[model samples]
Target: AVLGQRHEKNFRPIHYASKIITEAELNYTTTEKEMLAVVKVQLNELNELRDQAYENSLIYKEKTNRLHNSNIKDRVFNIGDRILLFNSRLKIFSGKLKSRWSGLFSISYVFPYGTVELSQPDEPSFKVNGHRLKHYFGGDRPKLVVPDLQTFPKDQ
Candidate 1:
């Protein structure tokens, strides 16, 4: 089994800002008009860069939303430790407390807004709260493994 490092995210910014552009050096020798033109051009470029950044953010957000909305919680599942959603079912209204350990809840009902719902195997549909579903008693069934296989005679 290959285990990787765990990154716990708690609503903290990963890198406050991504791809910061240094302000262009001022050309004092140039005329005011020329300087204004240069400023406009630089400003346009900056606007373009900002737009691209916003677009990238939207894409990232969409992906995150998709992953969160998916019922397959095991894949890309992160609670309070990474990305967070808004409202969810069962225990709706999560306060961005996502963690790897927290996301390991039920295998069913994953959605945005950081809330999940689960269904018990023996029991019918029942809503669970906060990653941890309400505990239920198991059926009193006989063990499938026989006593002979469970314990061998010392004499033999």
Candidate 2:
């Protein structure tokens, strides 16, 4: 049986080809030859199913890639632009509330096909997938003001 994605909704079997194995086909094995003979048939039909599975898999892959790429915006970073790198391997034992991004890295170089070279202050530059990067707007800092003593409360 071969299954395929006819629509984006669900998977449905597109084709099914079956052949029952005979006694001669199961000549060697001492196991349940009766059941084996009734089941496997020839490798040819299985091979056809395998080929169909591969073709269907390719279609699924293409569709998945299309859907994924759709959500991705093309980002072009200039040299010295601040960016954050997403930690792709941080899934294990990590809380979802914690940030997976690990950079205040600057773009040292940009290349084709969503590849980037990033460098952090006092650290060596490294190449990473550009999909893992996003622009950084700098960290937040609060301003402090000193008031004159004349405006200060004397009760304390």
Candidate 3:
């Protein structure tokens, strides 16, 4: 309407609405949304997996330990109180008083037993921590299988 009014350009009317928009606020909201999607969610999943692995490890370790304390050395461990472990690498795992898998992992239950069982994070089978497995037991236990320790990274 104002553009159509040419000629002498007679003054019209004046009006103003109270409003505000901050560039900083808009940018901040955008940044926060991105961070939540990329960082917070991923971190939460990783932490949960780690915690579950730790819990599973404790359970597996404790159960296997019962066999140790049961005074059934001939049935569980033929090599006396010690156990030998052979990791996926075929490396011999040796330990002083238990299954070799116990030494390699601070949390042993995180390793997958097979592709079927390993598919889900919640059902992770016992895997030797690989790192510390050598301290307590050998690389070969009765039926336990662990991932490749040399290539595997420490859990987050």
Candidate 4:
């Protein structure tokens, strides 16, 4: 009878230990599932934030473009007007004192959409974009005067 009582005590401890282990495993699985659900919710929120940031960037770019376009001044040109051509090639070389304008061209024709035909004294006329030309305010014609040497007294 004592042996049977000892066996019963051992069996009871083993059964209780297995029951405790099973409950611990169940709690661990439940916690893991809850953490996974939280991670999924956080991922969804991150995606939404990314989308909102992209939309805000697009809005900012559009507003900047509109402001820039509004600030641009319109230039008008007519036939027979004298203009100076902007020398874009000068930008390649470093020279702050050098002038970027290189022409006293006359506008032979003005076409739609900013195209212009420029004519020089002896050169053939060529078409150029109107944006490269600015009005020359110097004069209708340039003049040259030669000083007579006889007017000055000759030193002995």
Which candidate leads the pack in TM-score?
4
Local accuracy of candidate 1 as per-residue lDDT tens digits, 40-150: 666768999999999999999999999888855543433222222223453554646542122222335556753555443465543333444322223433434855556
Give the count of colliding residue pairs in each prediction: 11, 0, 21, 0
Per-residue alpha-carbon lDDT of model 2 for 108-156, expressed as tens digits?
Answer: 9989888889997788989998878889887732344786767656895
Root-mean-square deviation per candidate: 22.2, 13.6, 23.5, 14.6
Alpha carbon lDDT of residue 15, candidate 4?
16
Candidate 4's residue-wise lDDT over 1-156, tens digit each? Answer: 010113745632211111123454356664564454455556767999999999999999999999999999899999998899999999999998998988799999999999999999999999999989999988655444786767767899
lDDT of each: 0.45, 0.74, 0.42, 0.77
Residue 61 alpha-carbon offset, candidate 1, angstroms: 0.3
Question: What TM-score goes with each of the models?
Answer: 0.32, 0.44, 0.28, 0.67
Candidate with more favorable, higher lDDT: 1 or 4 = 4
Position 131, candidate 2: lDDT: 79
The full ranking of all candidates by lDDT, starting with the best, is 4, 2, 1, 3
List runs of model 1 lying over 4 Å from the truth.
1-30, 71-156
Output the worst ten-in-a-row residue range by lDDT, candidate 1.
Answer: 78-87
| Model 4 whole-model lDDT (C-alpha atoms) | 0.77
Query: In model 4, how large is the Cα lDDT of residue 49?
Result: 100
